[model samples]
Target: MKKIYSIPVFLTMMFLVACSEDFLDLKPIAMETEETFYKDFDALDMTATAAYGILCTRDIFDYYIFMGYASAADDVEVGGENTNDWPQFQAVDRLQHSPMLSTIFDSWGYCYKGIRMTNEFLSRVDKIRATDTKVNQALVDQRIAEMKFLRAFYHFYLAVVYGGVPIADKIVDPSMFSTPRNSLKEVYDFMIKDLKEAIPYLKEKSQLAPNYGRVSKGAARALLAKILLYESSYAKNYPGDERFAGMQERWTEALQYAEEVINSGEYQLVGINGERFASWRNPNGGVGGYRWIFTLDGDNSPESIWEIQNVMDGKGWTYTRGSYIVTYFTVRYYYRPSDPTHSDRVVGGWSFNLPTSYMVNAFGNQDSRETGLHSVPVDPKLDPRFATSIGRPGDTILVNDQTEGEKWFPMSFSNLPTQTISRKYECSPQEYWNGRTNDNEGPMNVRWIRYADVVLMAAEAAYMAGDKPKALNYINQIRKRARMSGNTGYPEDLTDISFEDIVHERRL
Candidate 1:
C-alpha cells in the first residue's frame, strides 16, 4: 500500500515540476505568433495581404460610416422609413455627430487596426531581410514598399477625416494604447514620406498587368499628389492655421507628381463602349461607359487606379467578401416581375443613400412633365452620364440576360419627394440571382481612386500654379470623355475653365 501511494505522489510531483519552468511561456498553439508565423516568404506575403483586407471591412468600406460622411454633402439624402432609422447617418447629415457616435468610432478603430497591421508587416519583413538570405530580395523590397503604401493610405484617411491621428509606425505594445494623436502636419508628412519611399519599389501598372488590383508606382504618385493637393487647398482656405503653414506652396510638387502619373501612360478613361482597354476583365459585361465603370465587369479596368476587390461569397451575414454597402443603395423590395419572361427582374435592397432632387436637377434642365422624384427625362436635356448615374422610375436596368421593364420608385416605402435610387453603386440582378451573393454581399469593387481623378487633380494643381491654359486643357479632356461616355453632343468642351469648373467636374 505505501509503495503504491509513493509512486502516485512521485508522478504528480514530476508533472508540476515540468509545467513550472515554461507553462505560461509556451508558443501560441491556436494561432500564429510573430515568431512562428513569419517563417517564409509566402507567410510574409500573406501578412502583407491581410493588411489590405482591412480596406474591405465593414468599418472601412462595407458599411454606412464612410457613406454617412458623404451625406453631409448636399447631393445625398439619408433615406429610410424615418430620420431615426439610421441615426448615425442622420447625425452626420445634420452635422451633430460626436466621437461617441458608433460609426465614427468604428472608422477610427478599423483605420488603426489597418495601420497596426501594416506596421507589424513592415517590422516582420525587415527582420526576415536581416536574418534570411534564401528569400527573394526583390520580392521582399516590393512587399515592404507595398506595406508602406498601405500604411500611408490608411493614415491619409484618418488625417483627412479626423485631422490629427496617432502615427503607428510599428507594432505598439498594449500598454502604449494611450498614445496621443499627432498634429495634422505630422500625419500628412508621414504619409507623404511613406509614398515617396514606396514609389521606387512599386511596379508601374503596365508591369503589374494581369494583376491590376495591386498598388502601382502610378498609384503611389497619384496618392501623394492627392495628399499634397488637399494640403495646399486646405492651407489656402485657412491660412491662419499654423499646422498647414507652407502647405500652399506644395501645389507645385502636387502638379509634378500628378503629371508623372499622367505621363506614365499606364491608365486611360474607358471609352464609350468598352473600346479602350478592352482586355480588362468584367465578369458580367455591359456597354455604357461610365455605367460599366461601376459594375462587376468593370473590376480592374485601366481607369481604376486603386480599386478594392470584392467577391460574391453568398455568405450573407457571415463576414462575406462582398461589398455589403450595395444592399443599402439598392431599391427596397423593388423586385416585381411584370412578365413571365422577365423572371429575373431587378431585385430590392434596404433602400438607403437615395439621391436628392437637387443632384438630378444638377445634371440638366428638368422637364415640366417630371413630377418630384418620379422624374422622367422625356426628351430630357440631361447630361448623358445622368442616365447611368441616377436610376429613376422609368429607367430600365439589366436583369439576368435581357433588358426588362422600367424600375418604379418605392412610393410605399417612403414619402420623400426627391428620393431616387443611385444606379452608380447598386447591385445588378445577375449579382443577386447568381446563387452566390445576396443583398448583404454584392460583388462590386469599390474604385477608390481612378485615372480620371488623377487627371482632375492635375487640372486643379495647374490652376493653382497660375497656368490657366494647362488647367483649361486638362478640364477640356475630362469634358470630352464625359461626352464620349454619354454618346451625346452636349456638355461641349469649355472655351475657358475656372476653379469652380474643376470642382463641378469632380462632383460629376
Candidate 2:
C-alpha cells in the first residue's frame, strides 16, 4: 500500500485543477467545427458539392417517386401483370384523395431537405475569401446565386405537390422549430423573388464552359415563365373575381420571358425527324446530341438550362448501382429468371408504373408524342410506340429482329375486352441488363425542367387568357414537332369539347 494510497485521488484532483482549456484540448476525434468548413476555396466547393448531392437522394429523380406521382395526374395507367402497387396513383388519376396521400408528404420533406442544404451553401459561401480574385469573389457570387436558384427550384417542386410549404432560407437552430405553412401565393412570390435576385448575379452562357448544367439566366427566365403560368392558372379558377386581378399581367410576364429565351437563340428544341429519335436513343451522343440540355451525365447539352449531374459509378453515399432506370422502366422480359437471354444481372422484378388505358386512348390511336415518348406495341396494328416505349415478351417480335424493331407486349384487363398496348419506355429485355455496366442503367438523363414543358405551359396560359389563336399556335408547334396532326378544334369551333381535351392534347 506504500504511496499507492492517494494515486486515484491525486489524479482526479490534477484533472480538475488543469483548467478548462486542457479538457477542451482533448477535442472530438471526428467532429468538425463550422468554421473549418468555410476556411478556403476547397471548403466552399464542398458546400456547392453538398448542394448538388441532394439530387442523388431517393425521393428525387433517382427513384421513380416524383415522375411516378406526377405522371399519375394525367391519364397514365397504373396496373399490369408486371406493375407494382398503384392504389395511390390510381386514386390521383381519378382525382380522389387516398391513403397514399402520404406519398406527397414524403416528397415534401425530401424536397425541403434539398432546399435546406442549398440555402446553407448560399448563406455560408460569403464568409470565404479566396486568394485568387478572378476565381474568388465573382465565382463565389455566381455559385451562391446558383444555389439560390436551386433552392427556389426545390421549393417550386414542393409548391406543386402540396400547394404550400414552410420556406426555410437557412439552417435554423432547434429553438425555431415551429413554423406554419405559407400560402401558395406567398411561396410563388418567394420563388419569383429568388429567381429575379439571382438573375443578375448568375453566370452567362459563356462563363459556364465545363460546367454548363449550372443555373443560367435563361434557366431562371424559363422557371419564371412556369411560375407565372401556374399563378395565372390558379387565378383563372376564379374568373371575374378581382381576387387575382394581376393574373393576366403574370401571364404576359411569362410570355415575355419565354420570348427572351426564344430570342436568345441559346437553346433549340431537339428536332424529331427520322434520325432524331434514333440519335437520342444512342448512348455515345451525350445528352442525345443536344448540348446544353440536362442528361444523366454532367455534360452540358443545349436543351438543358439547368440540370443535376448523375453518376452511375461513384463512391460513398453518392454511389448508385445504376439500376433505377432499368428497374422502373423494364418489362417482364428483363426481369424473368427463366428467359434464355436473361443475364440474371438486372435486379428488376416489378413494373413500378404503367400507362393507363385512358392515357393510351388519349393518343387517339396514333403515333402522338404521348405514345411515342413512352410506349411500344403489343399489337403491330396498334401504335408502334407501345412496342417502342415498352418491351416485348418474346425474343422476337413477329418479323422484327433489330434492337429498334417493334417489341410491344399486350396487357389484358379483366373488365376490358381489348388488350392495352405497352410502351417502349416501360419495356426492357433481360439481355440488355449488364449488372454494373453503365449501359445497363438505361438513359440516366431526366429533364427536371424542359423547354417543351414551358412551351406547353405558355400555350395553356394563352388559352386561359382568352387568346384562342395564340393557344392554337403554340399547341400546333408542339404537335408539328411530334409529327401529329394539328388541332383545328377551337372554343368557337367546338364548344362541346371539354378542357380535358386540351390537357390531353398537351400531354401528347
Candidate 3:
C-alpha cells in the first residue's frame, strides 16, 4: 500500500511541472516578439521593401507638384496659369511663398517617415545574432548603408529647399514630438557624415539592375558633389558666415566624388536629335525613342539615377488622370490650330509665371536646348528647342493617326501668342485630366537625379575650387551634348569670369 501511494505522488508532481513549462512558453508567433523579428534577416528585408513604397507616393511625383513647383519657382522654367486657383505658384516671380511650397514640406514628411522606418530596421538588425544561419550579414550591412544614404538624400532635399531643418537620426518616440530647426551648416554636416559612412558599403553602379535605381555608390557621390557645390556657392554669395567658411574645401571634395562617378563610366547621356523628335509620331516607338523618358514606362531607363514610378491603372492611383494640370495651365487652344473648331478653347487663359524677357534673351544664340524644350515663334530664326519645348502658333507636325494623303499634320498656335513660354516641364492638355488615354502627355516620370545634373554639379565644384580649365572642360562636355554651338562660355582669361557666370549657365 505504501508503494502505490508513492506512484500517485510522482504522477501529480510531473503533471504540475509540465503545466508550468507550458505557461512559460506562451509567446505568440503572429505578433513577433523583438527577439524573433529583429533577430532575423527576413524581417529586415520586409522593412526595406516598406521604405521603398514611400517613393511611389503621389506627392513625390505623378504630377507637377514637386519638381514643377520647385524648378519653376526658380528661373529655369515658368508656367502659365489661366485661373486664380494656383495663384501662389504663379507668384513665384515675386518670390512669394505659397501653399505650393507645401508640396516640398510633404516630401520632407514622407522622407522622414521613410528614414524612421529605416533607422528602426538598422537598430534592430545590429542587435541580431551574428551566428544566425538564415541571415546573410553582408546583405544586412549593405541595406543598412543604403538606408543611411537615403536618409542623407532626404535631408539634402530639405536643406536645399528650406535652407535648414531638424535632423533626426533615430526613430522619434511619441513623447518627443517637437523639435527646433538646425542651421543649414549643421544639417549639411550630418548629411555628409551619413553619405561618407555609406559610400564604403554601397554597391557599384554596374551591379544594380535597371529596376534597382536605389541608392548606389555613384548616386551617393553625385549627391555629395551637388551638396558641396551648393555649399560653396552659398559661401561665395554670402560671405562672413562661419557656416559657409569651409566652402572651398567642400567644393574640392565635391569634385573628387564627382570625378569618381565620371571615371566609373557607369552613365551615358541620351542622344537627342531631330530624328528622335520625329519618331514621337509612332505609338509603338515610345520606348525606343527619347520621348519615352517623359512617361511612366521610362522609370527604369539607364539614364535614371532615381525616378518616381507612377501607375494610372491601379486601385489607389497616386497620379491624377485627365488633362494634365500643366497642359490646362500652359497650352492655349490657339496653340493647336489644326483643330480649328477648338481654337477658342483657351483652357488656361491666364499666364501665371511668364518667362521674363530677360530669361528669353538669356538663351545662347545657338542653344538648341531652349528651342527644343520650349515653344517659340514659327520663324526659322528662333531656336529649335522653342518649337520642341512649347507649341507655337502656325506650327505643324505629323500626327500619329495621319493618313497617306495627309502625309503631315499642321498644328498652329497663332492665337496662342504666349506659346513662346516654356512648356517642356508642363503637362499637355489631354494629359492634364485623363491619364488613361494616350492623348494625355502630362503624367510623366519625374527624374530626380540625372547625368546632366551631375555633370553641371561637377563643373560648378571645379570652378569654385579655382580649377577653371577643369570647370570649363566639364561645362563644355554638357554644352556639346546639348547640341549648342560655339566655345563653352568658359573664357580664356579666368580672372574676368565670375562664379555668377557658372551659376547662370547652370540655371539655363
Instruction: Look at candidate 3 and tell me the lDDT of residue 491.
Output: 15
lDDT of 2 by residue, 188-255 (tens): 88898988888888865656776655778888888888888778777867556643444444677777
Question: Which candidate order results from sorting by TM-score in descending order?
Answer: 1, 3, 2
Q: What tens digits encode model 1's per-residue C-alpha lDDT throughout 164-271?
A: 888999898989899998888888889999999999999998887777667889889999999999988888898988766555558889999999998987887777
Q: What lDDT would each prediction earn against the true structure?
A: 0.73, 0.55, 0.57
Better of 1 and 2 by TM-score: 1
TM-score of each: 0.84, 0.71, 0.74
Q: Model 2, stretches more than 4 Å misplaced?
A: 1-31, 63-67, 71-74, 80-102, 130-135, 204-212, 239-249, 272-302, 314-323, 334-349, 365-418, 421-432, 436-440, 464-470, 484-502
Model 1 error, position 421 (Å): 1.8
Check candidate 1 and list the clashing pairs: 282-297
Candidate 1 ranges with C-alpha deviation above 4 Å: 1-32, 63-66, 242-246, 272-286, 313-319, 333-346, 365-381, 398-416, 434-437
Candidate 2 Cα RMSD (Å): 7.7
Error of 1 at 466 (Å): 0.9
Q: What is the lDDT of residue 324 in candidate 2?
A: 55
- Over 4 Å off in model 3, which ranges? 1-39, 61-68, 71-81, 91-93, 98-101, 129-131, 242-249, 272-278, 281-302, 310-356, 365-385, 396-417, 421-444, 484-501
Write candidate 3's Cα lDDT for 1-508 as tens digits: 9998999899999988778666878889689676676656776678876666666565553344533464354333344434244555445434665544755466677778877877777677666636458777677778888888878877876676677778888878877677888888888888889888888888876787654546778888888788777777777787887655544446888889888887777775554321342233345533222344444444455556665444444334443322233443344433233455634433332333344334454443233334322222223224333333444444444322222232233443443334454444443324343233433334555577777678777777887788877877776565444443111222112223345556545554
